[model samples]
Target: MAEQIIAALEKIVGANQVLRGDRAKPYLTEWRRAFQPVALAVVRPGNTGEVAALVQSCADFDCAVVAQSGNTGLVGGSAASDARRHVIVNLERMDRVREIDADNATMTVEAGCTLADAQQAAADAGLYFPLTLASRDRCRIGGNLATNAGGLNVVRYGNTRDLVLGLEVVLADGRVWHNLSGLRKDNSGFDLNDLFVGSEGALGVVTAAVFKLYDPVVQQVTALFALDAPEQAVALQRRLIAASGHNLTGCELMSRQAVSLACTHIEGCHEPFEVDHDWYLLVDLASSAQGHWLHEVMAQVVEHARRDGLLSDVVIAHDDERAAALWHLRESLPPAQVAEGASIKHDISLPISKLPMFLARALPAVREALPGVRPCPFGHVGDGNLHFNLSKPAGADDETFLAQSETAHTVVHDIVAEMGGSIAAEHGIGRLKVEALSRYKQPVERDMMRAIKAALDPDNRLNPGVIVD
Candidate 1:
């Protein structure tokens, strides 16, 4: 049966594209080297037709399929375990920017195109695809759509799901669902495109998508402010929202620990303020209007926050170079923490208002559970999502700290649940949080999700062991 399936896939997309045995070892592990899994073969299909054919072949042989793109995912969603029972369909070869409609403000891009490539294509077309994550250079569009990635610009442009106009998905049964319309208004039933956007390749494999683009910003301002506490950051966020309205683009929360790590590890990164505070807020404002004075608006926001005592010190970027440097500090937090040592990372979300309380409860509880653990919490606070990662104490053994991940995760996730938060936010519930979903999700909700998975992929051939059993 395995041979038949392999032969069928080879027939669809040449033998040269099908990697087996020792050749497929590289695709079996995740980017962080945290999870490794064996796969029968890693298949690279060049287009939607080839992907559809591969899916059909897997269905025929009752072989489980795992869709992989870029292999840059933090979660083990793309790794295939046990090759005898699993096959990896890598979309790296499917990269192509099919069309860029400047007038409609949309771009039709293949799933394997890098996020950086998509952004550059949009820029070339004099538009913007604002899903800018740190992994933009390596993460593919399909992976971003699969995860419904929320990045720095999500405060204004929304997530990857929001930016997508339509998708071209190859369903579990090898049937292609081509709903790639760039229409702004469609009262179409079900909106099936959304199902696969954040499905994590469980329901189907995304081959291509039509993404909504935005007018390039003519004026922008980035500012960093030191705040007394999370509450001050929240208050400042509200104040900035009221003052700037739609012009406000991003609001990121950074702990003193996060800032210190970035300064210590990331070269050319410095503290934004002289006096270190408990927390900091990185606020960005962008405007499409050509002559809009974003700098003046930013100045007003800083003045208001100061008068209100929500902010202690502020540093506004005077030019592009300064803005880039300020953003570098925030983006470097993750890598710096990694360099420090093994960290138990939690990408969770809660209500914007409940953030302070959530942190207040979760932080102390986590510390108590894992003594001397450093809490390095930071992320898109404006969108109510926080990374909430915990770094090991200085000189602590990496394996020892990682072994206690469950204890630390439970401490944090319990507080998040109490606040009606999601355990998996921008990052979908890949293999990492499947158990959490089973535990925290309401019985009926889980049943419904299961029903959907069963309905779409009855044989469980598409990305098995993802969101569903």
Candidate 2:
């Protein structure tokens, strides 16, 4: 059966594209190395037609197919994990810029285009694609669409799902479902494009996407501030949101431990001005009004925050170079934490109003449960999404604390659930948090999700064992 399928896939995409044995090793592992996946082969298809044909060949042999892009996912969904019974369908070869409808404020690009490439394409057309991530240079548009990725700009533009106008997908049976509509108000039917957006490749493979672009920012103002407490950051954020409105492009918070870790582990990242504080916020404000609009609003926010005793110290970027430096510090936290040691990570979202209360309760509970566990919680707090990751304390056994991950996760997730929050915020439940999803999600909602999965990929040939059983 393996020989037959390989031969058929080689015919669809060239023989050189059909990888086997050692050639398939690269495609079988995710960025974080949570687990190594075993696959029979990796097939690289150059276009939608080839992808459909490859999917068809897999179906013909009754083999499960796992779709891959820039395998940079934190969760294990980027590769198969059950056993060596899957065929990997990688989309890097299909990278292309099909069209840029700038007049219509939309760009149609193939799925394999890197997030950075997509953003650059929009910029080259004098527009802006607002999906920004640290891995933008590596993560692909396909994975971004499949996971409904959220990043720094979600408070302004929205998630990958919101920015997308339409999708070109290859279904389980290799039939192409092309709905590349760029209409702003298309209430014609069931909003079918949503099904595959955050499906995490459970239903189908996203081949290409029509993404909505917006007016480019003529000027941007970035600021870094030391906060007296985490709640102060929240209070200042509320005032800024009311005062600045949509001009507030991004808001992020880093706990003191998170900052120290970033400064200690990451090169060129350090405490600004040698000042010490309990928490810090990195704010990005931009305006299309061309002149002084960003400066006026951001200055007002900083002035007001200080008056309210919310800010301890503040530094506003006077030029583009300084702005880039501030952003680099904010983006360096994740890798810094990774460099420190093994940690249990949580990607969670909460009601903006309840963030302080959730943090107040969750922090102490987890610390008590596992005393000396270093909590490194940070992320886009502007939109209420926090990457609440925890690093093991110095001199602690990595394996021992990692073993207590379930306990640590439960403590945090329980509070999140009670506060009307989601356990998996920006990161999708890609085989990493499936049980947590099932536990926290209502049964009826789970049933509906399962029903959708059953209807679309009845054979479970595409991205099996992800998002759903």
Candidate 3:
């Protein structure tokens, strides 16, 4: 049966493009090593037509199809986890920048193009693509759109979903929906592009997209402030946003433990302050309007924060190089955690005003539940999303520490639910968080999602057991 499936895939997209067994191992595994998938074969499609054909062929054989691009997703969304017959449809081969309309401020590119490459392409055209991730070099625009990824710039530019103007998708039935018009406003029928964004490939495969761009930033300022608590960061952020006239592009919060981990594990990442503090806030402000005015705006905010006793010490970056250095400390937190040891991570979001209270409650609860567990909470607090990760107890076994994941999740997520926060923030409800989604989501909302899934792929052939199940 597997042999027949492989032969059919080869017929659609050349024999060399079809990989099986050991050759397909790379596509079958996701990042972070959380979920190891088993697929009958991995097919590489070079164009939209080939992707459509592959999907149609998989439906004909009753084999589930998983749409993958870049495979840089943190959750188990891009890979198959069950033992069912599955064919991995990887889009890495369909990388091309179809067009870049400078006047329209939109760029159309294949889903397989890396985020870094796309950003560079926009930069070459003297424009800016605001959506960025630390994994930009490895993550593809398709996966970014599929997951509706949010990163540092979300506070200013919003998520991948917001930056997109149109999408070219292949539905579960192998039919193509082409609407890459780069239209800013159109109220024709339902907003179909939205259904696929952040759907985690359960609805369809994003073949290509038209992304919105912005004017190139002419002046930018970066600053780091040492604070005593998350509340201080929040308070200072409000002052800066109001004073800067909303030019605050990004604001990130890091716990002392998180900062220490990054300084210890990552090379060239040094502490910004002379003395230690309990928390740190990284600030970014950009303006296309030319002037040294942004620097003055940052300095004034710093002075006000100090007067209000909101911060202890602050460091401001005046040049592009220093700005990059300051930003490095913020971006290095993730890789630093990987080096620290085994940790259970949660990507969650709450009301901007409720972050302080949520932290006040969740911190002690998780610690009391698991004694000596190191909490390294940090993330894009400007947009109210925190990467609330917990490092295992000192000298604890990895397996033993991981065993408490369910307990820790319950402790942390229960508080989140009470606070009206989402368990899955930027990351989608992939296979890893499917059960939690089922438990936390409202029944009405869940039923609507399931109805859409059933209507699109009744057999569950497109990414079966993902998001819906």
Candidate 4:
């Protein structure tokens, strides 16, 4: 049966594009090595037609199909679940920049195109893509849309979903939906694009998309502000937003432990302040008007916050090099955590105003549940998303610490739920958070999602064990 399925997939994408046995190892394994899944074959589809045909072939063979692009997702959304019964549909070879319309301020790119490449394409045309992730160089556009990824620029530009104008998707039944229009205003029925953007491939495979672009930022300011606690960071953020509005492109919050870990593990990362504070806020403001006004506004806001005792220290980047260095520290947090040791991480979000309360309650509860756990919390505080991760105690057994993941998750997630927050934030509810989604999500909401999933993929052939089930 596996051979029959692989042969069919090979016929669709050509024999050279179909990988199996040892060759399929990389596609079968998840990036974090959390789940070592198995698959009959890894099929690289070269175009939308090939993807649709492959999906149909997998369904006819009664084999599950998992849509994967870049395979950089932390969640097991792109990994196969069943041995020999799943065929991985990888889109790496489908990479292409279809079109760029400067008059419309939009660009159309294939699903497999790396985000870094897309950003460069926009830059070459004297525009900005505005979806900036740490993994931009490797993570593809399809996965970004599937996960509805949020990054540094989300405060100003919004999530991957918001940046999209239209999408060309291959539905579960080998039917292609060609809605790739760059029109800003489309009163068409139902807004079907939203259904697939964050579906994690349960509904369809996002083949290509039209994305909104913006003018290049000519003047920018990056700064790191020292604060005593999360509340101070929130207060300062509110002040900055009030003063600068949409010009505030990025605002990140980092705990002392998080910063310390980054500085220790990452070579270029260093503590910018003379005296270490309990917390830090990394923020940047940008404008295309080309003047010192952006900097002046940011400086005035920071100085005023300092006078109000909301900040203890401030280090503003005066050059592009320093700005990149500061961003490097922010982007290096995840890798630094990996370098530190095993961790149980949470990508959760809450209302910006409720952030302090959530942190205050979650930290103590997590500590009580898992004693000696190192709480290293930080993330895009401007957008209310926090990577509240708990590192294992020094000299502790990795397995033993990981064994307590359930307890730690319950302790932290309960608080998040109580505060009207989402258990899964930027990252989609892949296999890891499926159970949590069932537990935290309202019964009606869950039922609706399941109904939609059933309607789209009745056999659950596309990315099984993803968003819905």
lDDT of 1 by residue, 1-469 (tens): 6788788889999999999877887777687676777888899999899999888888778788899898888778887776686889999998999999998999999989999999999999899888899888989998998999999988888999898888899989889998887887888588887788899999999999999998998888889998889998888878777777777788999999999999999998997776789998998988888875777777887887788788889888889999999999999999999889999999999889999999889898988999999999999998999999999998999999999988988888888888899999988888888899998899999999999999998888888888886
TM-score of 4: 0.99
**Model 1 steric clash total:** 2
Give all candidates' CA lDDT scores: 0.89, 0.86, 0.90, 0.90
Estimated TM-score for each candidate: 0.98, 0.98, 0.98, 0.99
Residue 83 in model 3: shift from native, Å? 5.4
- Quote model 1's TM-score: 0.98
Off by over 4 Å in 1: none
Q: Candidate 2 vs candidate 3: which has greater TM-score?
A: 3
For model 3, give the 10-residue run with minimal summed lDDT. Answer: 78-87
What is the C-alpha lDDT profile of model 2 across 1-469, one tens digit per residue? 5677778888999899988878888887677677778888888999999999888888888888888999888888876864445888899987887899978999999989999998998899999999999999989998898888999888778888899889899999999999887777889889888889888889999999999998899888888889877788777777766776667778899888888887898888867757688788888887677687768888888887778788889999999988888888888998998898889999999977778888889889989988999888888888889999999989788788799999998999999999999998877898888888889999999999999999999998988889897
Off by over 4 Å in 2: 82-84
Residue pairs with backbone atoms closer than 3 Å in model 3 (clashes) = none
Residue by residue across 1-469, what tens digits does model 3's lDDT show?
Answer: 7778878889999999998777888887778888878777788999999999999999988888899999988888877864447888899988898999999999999999999999999999999999989899999988898899999888888988898889999998899999999999999889988889999889999999999989999988999999888899889888888888888889999999999999999998998888999999999999889888988988888888888899999988878899898888888999998898899999999988999999899999999999989999999889999999999887888889988999999999999998999998998878899899888999999999999999998889988878888
* Alpha-carbon lDDT of model 3: 0.90
